[model samples]
Target: MSGLFVPMTKANGLGNMPDLLEQWAGSRSVARAYGRAGLPMEVIQFPETWIPVDAIRSLFEISARAAGDRCFGLHVGKDMTHKTFGLWMKYSVQAATLRDGLIRANQSSRFQQTGGKVVFVPGAQVSFWRYVAPPMQTSSQVQHCDHLIWPTIRFIQSYLGPLWLPEWVDVSYPRDADARLLEAQVPFPVRFGTPYLSMAIRNRDLSPRTPRPFGDGQRITFDAVRASEAAGPSNETLGTVFNTITLRLLEGQTDIDGAACQLGIGVQKLQRDLRREGVDYRDLLNRAKRVRAQELLSDTDMTVIDIALSLGYSDHGNFSRAFRKMTGVAPSGFRARKDQMQ
Candidate 1:
């Protein structure tokens, strides 16, 4: 499979209005909610076009502000079922096993509004499928984290039957609000203020368990979704390239030729392919570095110098210059602003 896919934007919220509005508990008008969130009414009404991940988070913010319920995301997650994600959900649901379903969901996360990827990490006792996303500590981000994790929970229960549950659920962010609403819904213990976000599964349960056979029509729909996504944009390939560069950077491997070799292409071929898609390797590297740096600065209390070294900068001074050039603010200043806002 291609490297872990990260979409250019978080998953779109096209088909989630019914659930979100329902979660609002009729406290506010749809028009008022959209206006409050600064989202277009037509977008929520039509929902044919993809909404940004940020916008989905904004919707939760507005709902929380207007409804005074932090559990809004958990409520909205109830609608993120087969119908919400369309064919992608169908593929996941009809897979041979729960593991297969999670794999299918992981591959199509870009289309599913997952905003990030679900990675299965193996352990000696209990392995887990972890939800990975770009780091930013905001109420909206916390809600977005819920949007990514809770659906996976619901999907597992649906795929393995209602009796199924993950061994446990772990989230990176702290519990800033009452989690009783979520605890009541989940069968397993729900944990907060963890190092990462993950749903641990028993190692033995990772095997394929034939649920139900896929109907011919379901197969057709799955194939069509795959084809549509393949033809939609080159973001998947670009994401793969960016992931490679970032991983290599962490390993102190920063040469285009090395990345080309790892990708099994000649340097010239890699350059030509990226150029065809209007991508510059250096610019892409810079963009990835900027994003990684921002995530570290905002999500962790790591020193600026430490973050710079982690990003492969020779020194903090060079990292700061590049950061200011790209973001128009020093790293310290950015962190201070983010801290105040959060």
Candidate 2:
């Protein structure tokens, strides 16, 4: 298999699109749409997983057609919260100012998708935050682009107020039926057929501003998120395989077939690819399970049973034995040691 087979993206990049689709259409329609898009329903079941960007584009088209709404992406974006992107959004929001936050987001954009770039360009009077989509042709670019642009506007609104608007927004795709729909949603002008997708913000609005507060005590620190991202998958076949396994493990799924499906490949081909990298699927699964177990024990307050279930362990004794075998300590004892160190 070629390394450049298809571009992959974190499922979280789809944000609340699935839920919004369910609300507008129905659960059955959502299933049909996933089927038509050549994506397993498990992708939605585990938003932490990675899937092909093409599949996402297909989903956008099917969803829009089913709902008879050209601006479905905009609606999903408007309904999104900070939780849409999870730790990435948390890390950005923790910055000292909105400008700092945008810089941080640009730096950590890889956490959401691959083969795309988020550039933060500064100007004397105005600044531009641009999203460069991957070089792929699709009829659904408008929907996909709109999905990304509006949440960004909302992020700016976090620093500015709810009534705040951008000077103007740019869409890479040409004008379509949704152009008027897009215009109606934003108070500012919308430009189409531009070089790339971007929005203009005044330098004054990008200045120092207070971050929103999170009352949840379980909020992960910005440093922790950064460290996790730094330790993420590399640009290798083994790294991609390992990342897919880790994400599937979070949803209590450890089957090789599921991982292969998420990667848009076959089970035998996946095994062959891993062998070429000189690693076995079982070894990677065990490694991912151990890493996830340690993270859950140290970073969350969930009980041993819940953690075990999340890792796909059907029996508590089995999980305890595996945990001890991997880390040389029981889950409870591990958590205790982590707490003491803290």
lDDT of the structure predicted as candidate 2: 0.79
Which lDDT tens digits does candidate 1 get at residues 1-342? 343333334233433643456565563555676666545554443332343345566666666556566665665665665455566766776776777777876777656543466677779989888877654323545555565565676676665565667788897678765677767766679889875679888877667676666545446345676675552334756765675565455444568998787566888877876787687789778877887688778877889999898788999999999999999999999999999998
TM-score of each: 0.58, 0.77
Report the poorest 10 consecutive residues by lDDT, candidate 1.
Answer: 3-12
lDDT of 2 by residue, 103-127 (tens): 8788777777777778899998989
Predicted structure with the largest lDDT when compared to the true one? 2
How well does candidate 2 match the true structure in TM-score terms? 0.77
lDDT score, candidate 1, position 61 = 64
Per-candidate clashes come to: 1, 0
Which residue pairs in candidate 1 collide?
11-113
